[model samples]
Target chain A: MTPSLEAVGLTKRFNSFTALDHLNLKVEGSKCVGFLGPNGAGKTTTLKMFTDLIFPSEGESFINGISVQQDRKRALAVCGDLIETPEIYPSLTPREALEMSGALRGMRPEEIRSRSAAVLEEVKMTEWTDQKVGRFSKGMKQRVNIAAALLSDPEVVILDEPSTGLDPRGMAEVRSIVRGLKKGHRLIFMSSHILSEVVDVCDDVALLDRGKLLFADTLANVSQRLGGNTRSVEAEFAAPVEDSVLANEIGSLPEVASWSRADARRVTLQVKGGPAEQARLLRQLASLSMGLISFRESRSALEEVYLREISVGDA
Target chain B: MSADVAPARAGSLPIADGAIGTVPGTIAQAITLSRYQLRDYLRSRRFVLMIAIVVAVGTILTTLVAYYRPVGLIDNANNLYGSLWGGGAAFLILFAGIIFGGDAIAGEFQNKTGYFLMGLPLRRVTVYAGKYLAVLVASVVSILLFLAIVVGNAVFYLGVGAVGDLGQLFESFALALLYLLALMGFVFLFSSMFKTSLYAVLVVAVLFLFGFSIIQSVVLALTGTEPWFLLSYVNQIIAYPLTGVPEHVARATIGRATITNYAPTYFEGIAVMLGYFFLTTIGGLLLFEREEFT
Candidate 1:
């Protein structure tokens, strides 16, 4: 069965200040959707609504096709969430914390026992399983927090900036741990203002700003939507290559709208069609043996998209 | 934990929400949560510290009564019990409740742990009830342990027979438990109403310790009436049972006019205390439910 999350004209107001305004979006399971926006964009607010931490001024949130506002318990049964930078009780060990979470989620004692071990290992926190969380670092606490969130093996996992306050190593470790949660085709809804964080973990992105959904689609589709019927890709190579010779070799491909040498080892090309033709061109370019290091879309596409959408909303 | 967000690694199938067995009922959830709460308190240093204080106080009281036999205080074990537990019982009940329940809901919000809890499948009322139940059980245990110290002293001084009537002690013990529940509910109400634990603790301390008594005295002096609604006024019924059966509405002549002084009977005390239990417990839950994690 398909699990889904939807926000229907959802609005939230903190008295005179409106946090979210008639936000409408729906997402299905089996995809890692990034809830992306800048600070004060209400990404966190929207996530809170989905979990019913705060009631909305208007509208409703549905999870797994059940109304969260009307029946939060049933709606949230399939969800596991880590919102903001919530800390566990300092006195509680990782084992106890996960056990409590698992027990509340209705897992059997045997299941809690087994999954407690499993999730701790998943987050690489087995060593600190019995250690009081008080002495643990922020990163350590965060890992334990995530472990608790996954205790139920929820179909939909929600995290707000899973690596927000961690050091670089901690962030990398968190990202790596998040990568390991791909078993059983669970839907991971992660929110972050950090573009790199979203880009690193999300398969699709829902962009919100000032509590409004500006865009929602796969990266490729977003490029198509905002790149304005065009795709600009940058191909990077390992060593310096003759620009003219490189351009001349694949310059005549029908999908190549235009090609320019970014530098001795890089070429910026405006391409057309979609992933199919792009793959075909990649094969042709790789065959040239011009030290073709890596080929991917240019950042300008999303940079342009962010600026366009946010600026329009600002207007 | 989030699944890999990179496009290449995301899952390609949707797992159903009810794939797992159904979430347990709310009551079951509350009990499961309470076990953790109890364990937390049991393991905490405060529990040990509180116990040590009670033992020390009991030892001093026991020694003073047995050897010194101060003035007219200890005519018998019954008198000794009444003197030891009288006003001191109110403080015990109030202190025990505050120590456990004062930070209950506020700590969750202050520390942002409520975000983690509210995100779960259990309802808000389940969490509130769980915390309250945990505090109630723990407070009852703490208060009883203190009473045991006093009882040991009574047995040592006046022998097992002098420890007062077992039935009365039991009745007193029952009243103490009721007081525990009522006071805990009051603490929980403050806990839920406030956003910070420090404020919750302070408000509870000030109100229960001195604020209520002062207000009750003032109300009685001015209105020529007993403050029947004030918990501290009616809470005396616990120790009053140790001395005599209370007249529900005691009357006395003061100054020029005959003023009435009201003291709750067993049932009146139960009614007032249980009213506190239900009213504040429900009030706290409502506040807890409406609160935003942000």
Candidate 2:
């Protein structure tokens, strides 16, 4: 589990404004880690620093344990970075652009030819390989942009809000691509502002606020630790039940603070106690004439922890 | 670098097929990037426009020289050197620099192309050197093509024997290229300084075409001093080969004031162009290196 990407005391300042403070983070192994933050939280700045697009005011970053500032050529050689909204030359065809990019990475002739096809297909842009990128839509351009990053088959793929400005369909397509990349032995680090997007695609979340790492751990850990005893649970029924019966059953549970029948077969309840009381309620509901099919947390617990941490940082 | 990134297994990457070359040195990367960038420039619309402009001007100059055959212009060498390099070549060099180098650096930042390029393992100095070489090749090719057409016509009208002193044409050509490098260096400097492509192109075009001459004129008019420091003074050497250069010239009685026009010698002209080349080229690269893609 050697670290794929590491930042040590990294900082960036612009005149009086501090874009990123002294920050340290190390992501190891092959997995998708979500770099989450509010707008102006220095996600893009961190990505830029990793790629050596700008020098850090203090400290440094490393790729595969090679200091980026010391040996940038070797450090980033195995990385594919898509920072902000990077555009390929409008005049170049996708194939031509990929070939150029491959050559720049020192790939041989046959390697460029072969990888040009492979990356174009990976981004689902094989059909439009010969067409000029100038005519491409924003989503198509973004796909090609990501495709360029994949040309080198980098061990660490750094995407800075890849879904930004893409339509819903484009977002879904990019998400699918990210999901597909997980099977490979590559560490994908993507930054996004959307909470649900991170929850859906990332195995780990590193939340930042005001240029500080608020928390960095598994989504499950964050949700479990922050999900308090008083939690909302959604219950689904096998068949429709009358409103009177649902109310009588709701009144029978002492732990239930509030209850509502969302539909003929579903009920949402705010249980006051922890998991034990919630489990007792489920058992009690199963014993009743009301047939229960499933029970689950009503909302993403990660959202709660995120809000709490962000508020604390703000204070 | 962390155990060679998992031993570079063949086709382990979805994008790459079997194997790839080891990461190259800075010079190697720069050369590779330059080759592609040069190809892109050659295929660009600006390159086509530059060719057309050079062709049109060369045709007009040749046609006029063949039909009118200026009275004092004794031979093909005299006519070719005087009108072609003196007029057509000077403007071509300026236009070539403007057409290619104006948006060279600014376009990367303005278009956000640098976001991806700078993300690569390559250094900023590599990117800068690659682009500089690309523009240089494009400009030199265009200028030489224009001169070729003029030379071809020289053979047609005045015969090959009449154009004996062709060596002077080459010397003039060399001088023109030196001026082009200097002008393009300035263009690149402006390109790196500004964020907008239009501003870079406009500023360069204005200064080269009319701004330099106007400034030089104003300085001389106000101070009664020769503007030897101006690069435009040295640019005159591009055409000076065709016409005999006097040691110095003085115009009398500009409303009871006499003014001197100092002519730069061949060595002096080269020194001036080299100064611009070094000063602006270094400045441009420094600006490009320090610039942030934010």
Candidate 3:
């Protein structure tokens, strides 16, 4: 069965406050879909409902067409999840923790042992297999948590802010692990507020704010659909140019919507139109003999869409 | 650098083609969870602390019997067992229930470990039963340790041949086990009621240690009625088998008031324990099932 996760009209309310409101989304096939939302935007709440950690107040969540509310065990049989920052028993070792996870899923002892080793190595925690989790750093424990989620190798994997509390290197390592997960033909539904991480790992992005979904589409399509006809790029000059000289050169270009000096030698430009317009503006700037050194996108296309949609959502 | 990024081989463990291994039934899942949970308990500091408490209580009883050599205690096996085992078994059971079960359910939520366990294919019933089973096993180990010390003292004082009423001693032990069950059920209910381990442990400790006894006394004195509904009242049966059943009620006059004392009969005691075991255990599971991991 092609792995799929669907949330139809899902709503969750804690007394007067709605944590998730009428969320409707369906993700299918083997790809990474980022559940992107700011903090307190109900990203975690939605994932909890999918994994049956919390029940939906209205509508339903389904995994591979099986209703999570009706038959949670069977529906989740093909699913693996790491929701919130789940702590393993401090007394347990990584291997022992993974073994328990496998046993709970009904894997035979031999299978559990073999898969436990494989997953530990996968998360690069083989050296810490027998070490007590109490002795591990936050990053190490998070890796073990991820390894437990992958122990069964289910068709669908859900991760909730897997790098929420990690250092820069730790965050990079988690992103690398997530990128590798996408290669195994599994549908990865990951929630995060980190836009760069999503752009680096997710094939599709779903923006949510204040319990409402603002947009959902592929990364490329999000920029095209919502980014309008303008794109931002940073340009570098070989020498420091005066602000007026730079403005006159950029202002002469019909495609240049706006410009700002980032530094003595760098300027940011907002160009009208798509890639053609951007290329034309780049050429026009180069012909001006203003010592153009480099030109590149200042922010990711998804980041732009994310900021715009989130600000619009705030409104 | 962004475009050059490729999928690394970090989490690409071999994926199973379709569904992973067949998910176990609830019973199997509960057994697996209980086995691991028991291992954790065995390695925990709390387990060591419980052992220490049992040994301390046993040593104090042994030293008192040896140094003083009270005629009331060493004169006969029944008196020795009754004074030591019967008099002290309920307290040991109460301590065991508090130590093993006070934070069993609440810790899962407080520490966020439930987030890891609840995401699996296991049902909430399985998790509840598994933790309860682990707590029961740990409590039983502590109870048995206390009993061993009691038996050791009995043989030293009365001799093996003179140790009286082995049958009655076993009956008391059985009743102690029932009381343990009922007390643990009550403890787990409180644990399930709170999301913080400190609250659960504090509430269970307070109620068992002083709250119920005070309430039982107040109820008996104020109404001149039976405190049969109180677990502390029913627990007297644990010792009654060895001490012989006490009177159902006794009356005394104090100032202008008639004060009443009551003892639960074997049948009433067993019934109340069974009622607590069923009602509180089931109630705890229902609460756990409905609680959201918010």
Candidate 4:
């Protein structure tokens, strides 16, 4: 099946500064693809290019099958976007802005009303419909923007930093709302300095660093591909064992990937293999009178991967 | 243009008739876009308030002037010319220019909202034209209301008298609108060029209010030539009955030499204004087309 959105060798430059460089991306229809990066890593720039907010200085992007650079309007017909800092005429209430957006997108007036009401309810912003968006808090404005985006029932939705300035509950609500959209439309979500949010929601993720795509794959696939001989365990002592003894116990485990005295009373171990192997190693440590405090798999989180890749680019 | 660029059907869905299909027609899109813009303008309370005040002031001033028949050559000249300078024409141009033109692109950039609006299924040109037409319509509406008040006063006070100068009045009013349009076009151009509303307003005001006048005066004084053909110098060309007015020594005015010497003919003035209007608008849009909004 044809991809819903695709970018090949996309590059953008602002005078002397290269904002994006030789980057490639693709999102299969009906999937939520997370874009992960650091500040100035080109995530926003790439999203802008895809939405036709900014032209790619090099390469091309397609929405559905139409080239965004060539037939921008046709390509945009199936797409809706909410970039950073949602804008509306300050005096217009949320409902008014949504109505105008709906009309412009060719929705019938009735469709506009129903769709606005539906999306407002979905975003939990129904009560704020009459309030001017200018008076809204950032999160409220974002919800209004999201409502406008959904008015046309677009086939693809692109959100940049979608959860910025939202409360925890608001963030979770937005996440679920985006997840709900996955069955009917593809989603391209860009976030810098927010890994866990994307990790929880995206089917696939592309990690970027200094305007280049470092890795793009499913979360599990990326973890497997970057597999390392490392694991972590936390062990407690019934009577407070000495660090020396704990270290010695940790050193004795044959599967111990690495060991160190985490503190005077506990030892942390890095072990080879997966969580199962790590669990067995923890049990062995328990036999040595080192009662376990807690244990978790020791590996690179998305944050670590993001930092490591960006630092590498810096070098 | 490929064969695929045919007009769209109802609901704007693509037809797979083996023939090349274009996007929806420009007319439909233009209508929708313009409607959206008009709604925005009307919904803006500040703009609505400003319009109401402008219209009320215009009507009040016209009624009082026509009733009193304030007599003086300049007063009579102002009756012919005051509408141009004082009848909210300049004020409307400046005010509408800011509301409609200043925020055209600058606010989009400053707010970082270009991504949302520009991402829609509309060409950049369509968006620009729709906005321009909407502003033009709004400006025209307000100014026309002001005109209606003036004409009403003329009928009431002048006793429906034959002025024998209806053609001149038409010429003056038409020229005023053209001048305002040209002014708005440059303001739009400046708005597109800058990334802040204040900068756009400041630049346009300087060009029209000060820069154009200063340069015109310098040229006239230095070259001993007629420079009223210049935009700022030709205010009287389209909006006044004054063929001559002695320079006012009590009130300091710049560009005296320029206004006295070389004002453009009505046709020449119209050509210049139209040229500026069309060229600046197209140029502004073209520059905007290639710009990357961050």
Candidate 5:
């Protein structure tokens, strides 16, 4: 059976303010889908509903094809979630906390002990397993939270902004752990406002704004379709080229939509079309005696698409 | 991804295999939750504070009894037990309920721990029942410690043979336990009512400590009617088995008007306590069930 998560017409309202409006999304199989949105884009609200931490005002959430609102226990039996930085009891060690989690899930003592060690190791919290959570840092607690979510080896894991409050190194470590999770047969639904983080770890990206979904698709497809038929590339030269000569040569190429010089040796261009067009432009550049050293597509293509979509959504 | 597809049956889907086992029933889940929650309570600072309060109260009473050596209290076991256990047990129960249960549910929201527990395959009712059970057990332990101190004093002052009527003492103890349950039910209701632990703890503490007593007094003074509905009025029954039931109503005329004092009968007290236990416990569970972890 395939792991799946679905939100059918899911809507949530706090008084007059709608946190999530008519959300309908479904993810299947073993993949990591990033739920991307701005500060108040209802990302955490949606994940809370899916985890049964908050009830939906309209529609329903389902886990593995079981209705979350109707049969929460059975629906979440094979699911694990870390919603909004849930704190463990200060008095309890990670081992004790995970033991409680495992017991609640009906895991036997032997199973709990072995799995506790395995998940603690997976989160790189093996040394702190017996230490009280009160003494751990935010990143350590977050790792313990993640380890608890993985204690049951759940097929579907829901994480709400796992790296929201972490430092740079902490964020990198969390992303690495999330990347490692993809190796298993699991459907990971993670929410984040960090665009670059989503680009780094997510296979599919679902963009939401002001309680509405703007688009949902694979990262490649989103970039290709919404990239406005153009891609940005950067070219580095071994030596400085005359401005007039560089402009005249770039203007002669039909594939070059726009160009800008970062310095005497580096030039950025918005090249028209796909890899073939980029290849033709690079060939044309190499043909000129401009001492070209290296050329690569800039990594901000997704950022451009995201900004455009979000602006369009706001408009 | 398709949103229109029908939901798959849970049985048809791949259940978590290997180390993961089937989820337990509600009772087992509640018990498991109770075990962990009890562990937390045991290690908490409030538990130590409660024990200290009990010991301090016991120490004060012990010193006064030993120094004064009151003929009435030292000569008879019933008077000693009634004055010591009956008089102090209610306050101990109130403190115990407030210390252990005042934030049992509200702390989950304020501290954001529910975000972790509620995501699992456990029901709201299970969480409520489990926390209530933990509070009950912890409160009982404190109450029993106070009782031991009372019995210790009785043995010291009146000798082993004069340790009061064991039957009446046990009956009073049973009544005290009943009162503890009712008070905890009320504490839990307040805990479920608010999202902030401070508010829940304060409201419960004030109401149990003096709020209800004041209201009971006001009602009796103004209406000249029985305050039988009040838990404070009914709590007198915890000691009445040892001290003998008092007159249901006593009226005295000062200069202009007559003031009335009302006492709850054994039947009325038991009925009121049972009503509070059922109504407040069920009401708290319902509130917890509907509350969102927002």
Candidate 6:
């Protein structure tokens, strides 16, 4: 099957600012690929180029093998996009907005109505279908925007920060809906800042920093590279304590490789792990009246890989 | 989990517009986009408010004119048509054109929603054409509403003996449509040129209210050129059907008067305005086709 989206040597610039530099990426059909990056790291810019919101300054992109620059209309016809904030007509209800979108894509009226209702229901926005989006809360509007993107049953759906403002419940709803879409269209979502959402929904990830792709691979591979040496154990003190005392205790633990104060009240430990040593470390923290916030004995998460790659630049 | 496991599913690659199936012509794509725009514009509260205001203003102006300068029964049809078409209809379309067309593309840029919209399954021409047609239709709707009010007022004034001149009335209305199209063309051009809606509206307002007039006066005064050379003069070609030909002050007779030569005939004047429309529109599109989102 044709790859749903592909970009080879895609470069875009704004005067002196290089938003995306020689970025190469490919997303297979019927999969979810998370576009991971930090702000000013070209995540939104890349999405813009793919969606043809802005043409690339240097290289080219193709959707289903159609050049984005050479044939914008056909490319856009099958691709549904929600970039940045979903700034739709304030006076339009979710239903009206979707219906309008469906008509633009050449869907008939009855098809628009049924499809719109189904997408809204899938996003759990049926209750707010008739209410004007102007009054919708941020999470509510995001869901409505997602519904609009899905209205035409696009073969490729690209979302930039799709879950930015969603509450936990709303975010989960979006995640599951995106996951369910994995069976058909290729889904390319930019979740640069929201690491957890990317982890939960995306099967693969492309880590970007400073307008360059640092790593583009399966999430599992990226995590394993960083996760093998990392552990996230949070300890909260019952009372304020000196760094020296806690640091000494943490330092003496043979398996502990690094420790960092997450906040004034909590210290997160990174330790080598085995069942016996992991239990001992928990006992030591328990005896000190250090309330355990979280304890995980697992591999590195997307967050760790992201921080590790980015921190190397900072160092 | 196997560390080397590639993602079992690969999302698809980026594709161009109209490639999934077939790319339609620019006009076809534009028309489809315009259909949605028309629906949205009709439902917009601002659009509704604009119609109401135009109609109310037309009614008030027509009533005041009838009461103050009551024409004898002999020329009642001509007199009423003149008052409404010249004064009420002209003014309402001016305002309507500004409201509907002055911010067409600029609004898309300002809201950043263009990011999603410009990426659609059509070309830039389709996007632009769609928006322009929608604005044109919406402006026409407002103008039509004002026309209705004027016609209604004429019926009330003439009462039982009143004979409304349907022929002259329609002629005036057709001319109004041409005037609106020409004027709105300029406004849409400006809308696409600027990124901010307010700036687009302001520039259009100035051109309509002052810029064109000022240019006409200066060109006529200094260069001894016809005022028709100015955009505002061209507009009068359409505006003068309601009011009889405006008397031109001879430039030689008055040292300070801006009038230079006689205004062009209606066709010549329209051609000139059409020239301005084509220039500005092409210019705006060229600029927009290359502009960055930031």
A1-315 in candidate 5: lDDT tens per residue? 678899888999999999999888899889999998889999999998998888999988888877889878888998989998888888899999999999999998999999999989877899998898978888888989998998998889999999866789878988998899899898999998787888888998888899988778888887677446788799998998778877788765899988888888888888888889999998989988688899998756667777888888878
lDDT of 1 by residue, B1-294 (tens): 111121221222332544355688999999988888888887887678667666676667677676887755554655566767664667777777877888889989897778767888889999998888888888778778877776776776667876545566677788888888888888988999999998999999999879998999899888867687888887888876568876766677778877676776767778999999999988988888888887
Clashes of each: 3, 0, 0, 8, 0, 32
Please tell me which model should have the higher TM-score, number 5 or number 6: 5
lDDT (Cα, 0-100) at B262 in candidate 6:
64
Tens-digit per-residue lDDT, B237-286, candidate 4 = 55553233333222335866223345466656667888878888888888
TM-score of each: 0.85, 0.88, 0.93, 0.84, 0.93, 0.85
Q: Candidate 2 A-chain TM?
A: 0.84
Model 6 residue runs over 4 Å out of place are A227-269, A273-294, A297-299, B1-29, B72-74, B157-164, B239-261
Q: What's candidate 2's i-RMS value?
A: 7.7
Q: Best candidate, DockQ-wise? A: 5
Q: What is the C-alpha lDDT of each candidate?
A: 0.79, 0.81, 0.86, 0.68, 0.87, 0.72
Which portions of model 3 show Cα errors greater than 4 Å? Answer: A226-228, A272-293, B1-17, B162-165, B251-259
Which residue pairs clash in candidate 5? none
Each candidate's interface RMSD? 7.4, 7.7, 8.9, 9.1, 2.7, 6.4
C-alpha lDDT of residue B238 in model 2: 84
Candidate 3 lDDT score relative to the true structure: 0.86
List model 6 lDDT by residue over A72-104, tens digit each: 766677777888875666767788777666666
Range of the 10 consecutive residues with the lowest summed lDDT in candidate 5 chain A:
A220-229
Q: Point out where model 2 deviates above 4 Å.
A: A1-3, A229-248, A251-298, B1-20, B162-164, B249-256
DockQ of 3: 0.37
Judge the docking of candidate 3 as incorrect, acceptable, medium or high: acceptable
**What is the alpha-carbon lDDT for the whole of candidate 2?**
0.81
Best candidate (score: lDDT)? 5
